[model samples]
Target: MEHAIIIVVILTGLGAVFGLILAYANKKLALEVNPLIHVVEDVLPKGQCGACGFAGCMAYAEAVVTRPEVAPNLCIPGKDPVAKMVAELTGKAAEAVEPRIAQVRCAGSNEKATRGFKYAGVSDCVAANLMFGGDKTCKYGCLGLGTCASNCPFDAISMSEAGLPVIDPEKCTGCGKCETVCPKKVIAMMPLTARVRVNCNSRDKGQVARKACSSACIACTLCVRECPYQAVKVENNLAVVDPSVCVANNCTDAKCLAKCPTKAIRPAVLGIVPGAEDQAAVERACPSCIKTNTAAG
Candidate 1:
């Protein structure tokens, strides 16, 4: 009993001494956390979507608190209200940033697009795309295996019955999570104010594109010729719309939508159809091109 008591006493004394040493080391070695970092983090959406170019919300919070160059309006998911709050927190000017939402660039639905082979591998877009550019004949088309939808922190993306990702504008925080995860690079960050858009991203020639998918952009240059503001261009057998130029000219006319033989050029807003009046203007824009397309059809 005497030996046991002595051992316990010695152990207790050593524990107390070690505790004191640890406390002193902690006080000396602990990194001080800035109070502003917590405040900035609190204001953040906590989505950690990396839209602000940071790894996560906490990282962005630390960066904004420590760095003078970081913009307060970089939080796209937070939008204007959060930007205002961030500006107030950092005592910096909040620049007005136009809102952007994810748009599926490919219109190659299962019904419209031809399949090269069956993809019986992993259900991920990136994984499925490893097998000779996916099952879709259109190499650039979305695999529609829910890789983008699964990665979306905001739950804005959902796979449609047609095997395409449908982004909900209301739920979308513009975080770019879906855009980053898509292996096909079919997802695009489109400005909310964009009036016109090319739904297709196929680089195939007109004939090949039509064979792959009915809605594929043939790079007809009809849109390029029809756009009065010169905001449209055919690059790599694809029609590309310059939203900045169109917005600058206040160009809202859907002239390109009418001229597209494959119905690939469309309004940026989902579910809304362009007016029929634009078709009359397309005939006037390029009569010979329309005549050739009609003859080919």
Candidate 2:
């Protein structure tokens, strides 16, 4: 009994000594965090959505405090409002942060796209993509599985009936969360002031694209021809909008909107609601699916 008691006493003494050493070591090795980091962080939204390309608000705050060129206004979700707040806290000028929104480039819905097969697996876009690209015949269309909608922290993206994401600009703070979750990379971030966007992301040839999805851009170059400001450009067999010039163009005559066979070119000013339906019937249902399918064939 005496031996056991002595052993216990020794162990307790050793533990106490180790504890003291650990405390001293921690005090010596601890990182000196700036008091201003907390101040800057307090002003941040703490969404940690990585809109600023930092791991979190704390990371951005660290960079802002330590570095000079790391602008405090890179936070997209925070927008200009947060940028100004951060700048005030860090004693820096707030850079101009143009508000941006997430856009779904794919118009290929179940109604608009021809499916090669039916998906019956994990029911997620990530999983569906592993098994031969996706269920949709179009190699570059949304899987309509709502992975993006599910991952969105602000509930900005919602799945429509025909299998496409509908972005609520009001809810979306341009967090870029939806853009990251999308496996197809069909989503893009454009300036809120942008008045036009190419709704299609397909890089396939015209005939090949038509067989996969009816709404796929055929690379017709009509938009390039119609734009008065020289804003539109045909690249990679797809039309792309130069956001810099596009936001300033007066091309809202509905000319490009009309000439687009697939209605892929939507005016950003009119606040185009990206839908699964065709350009005209996008707001409603297809007036010519059954009868028209028979007539066309």
Candidate 3:
């Protein structure tokens, strides 16, 4: 009994000594985390959207605070307000963040896009895409399974009644969560000041594209010829617009809008509404339209 009691006491003493040693080592070896990291993190939107190219807000905060080379204006969701705050905290030069929004490149709605087969399995886009590239005949078009909408942290994307995702420009911080999640890569981030965009993503030949989706860009090259500033070009069976060139040339006419046979190239200002009829009417009424008509007449 006495030996057992002695053994217990010795073990207890050894455990106490080890605990004290660990405590001392912990105090000595612990890396000091700069309090500024927490301060910077608090200033962040806390979306953890990884728009800043970091894993999360805390990691970005630490990087900006600890790394002198890291730019302070990387947080896209916060826009200028957050950039300025971060720049001030980090004593770094603040570059003006160009405001941007998420744009769904495909105008293929349920009524417009021809369906190859009915998807009955998982509702996810990635899962649906695994089975013969989704139900839509247009392989490059949005799956309309709400994968992008569901993954968007800002609730900026919502599935339209037409089985297409509609992006709310006001709510979209251009964090690119929707863009990242889209299996077809139909979602794209664009400058807020961009005046026009080609809404189609299909690289199929003209006839094949039109067969897949009535609204698809047929690469007619009408937009390329009509663009006075040479901002539009047909590449890979799709019409692409260089907004920077358009802005530099001050080409507000958007003559390409009127020339596009399938209306694939559209005014980017119109939030991602599926129908092109309304957009056509709005484009006709713009000052540029009036001027173009007057000059032609």
Candidate 4:
């Protein structure tokens, strides 16, 4: 018992010595984090969405402070406010970055998309996609099982009763989490200032696509012919919108909306809601007055 006590005492003394050494080493040898990096990180949204090409907000902040070439305006979700704040903290000039928001490319809600079969398996989209490309008749359609919502670090996405994920533009930082998590690649980032979008991702032929979903783009090239500035084109059995072309030409006529037989093209204004009385007028004119009331409704 006496020997054991002595051994315990020696061990206690050694442990105390080692602990002191470690604490001192930690204070002396540890790399001091820059105060500006912390300030920069605090200004960021901490979404970890990888829009800044870094692992997370902290990683981006460190890079911005340490690297001379890393730009301050890389944070897509933070937009101008955060960019300016980060730039001020880092003593750098903030470059203008176009703000963006997540958009559901597919208009195939549960009510719209035809179901091949009831999905009885796991809830994960990636897991569901592995089994015969999910339950939707449109293979490229969203699984609508909340994978994107689940993966989103920010609470910007919610599963709608229509069996589609609805994004809140106000909450959305355009972190691209929903875009990355979507197995069908049906989610995309669009400029926040966008006024028009083709809300379909199906590459199936017109007949097959129309049969699968009422709102599917038939890829009839009507949009291509109607776009005066050639901003809209039918490619890979889908309608793609080129913002640069549209913006450069100041093409606000939106002839593509009227030309789209399936009514696949939609006004993409972020927050505005179109009333029922204006729906028909919007259908005819395709003006900035009508927003994407489909998803919000």
Model 4 scores worst on lDDT over the 10 consecutive residues at 269-278
Candidate achieving higher lDDT, 1 or 3 = 3
Q: What is the lDDT of residue 30 in candidate 4?
A: 95
lDDT of 4 by residue, 201-279 (tens): 9999999999999889998998888777878878899999987777777766677776567778877744322111135
Give, for candidate 3, the lowest lDDT window spanning 10 residues: 277-286
The TM-score that candidate 1 achieves is: 0.86
Ranking by TM-score: 3, 4, 2, 1
Candidate 2, residue 65: lDDT: 77
How many pairs of residues collide in each model? 0, 1, 0, 0
lDDT of each: 0.83, 0.78, 0.87, 0.82
lDDT of 3 by residue, 56-132 (tens): 99999999999999999999999999999999999999899999999889889988999999999998999999999
Question: Model 1 over residues 1-297: C-alpha lDDT tens digits?
Answer: 999999999999999999999999999999999999999899999998999999999999899879999989999999999999989999989989789888788888888899999999989999998889999999988888999989999988888888888888888988888888888889888898887667787888999998999889888798888777888888899999888997798764556665677778766655322221154444543355466557878
Residue pairs whose backbone atoms clash in candidate 3: none
Off by over 4 Å in 1: 1-20, 271-297
**TM-scores of the models, in the order given:** 0.86, 0.86, 0.89, 0.88
Residue 143 miss distance in model 1 (angstroms): 0.4
For candidate 2, the 10 contiguous residues with the lowest summed lDDT are 281-290
User: Which is superior by TM-score, 2 or 4?
Assistant: 4
Where does model 3 exceed 4 Å of error? 1-21, 276-281, 284-297
Query: Which ranges in model 2 have alpha carbons more than 4 Å from their true place?
Result: 1-7, 269-273, 276-297
**Which portions of model 4 show Cα errors greater than 4 Å?**
269-281, 284-297
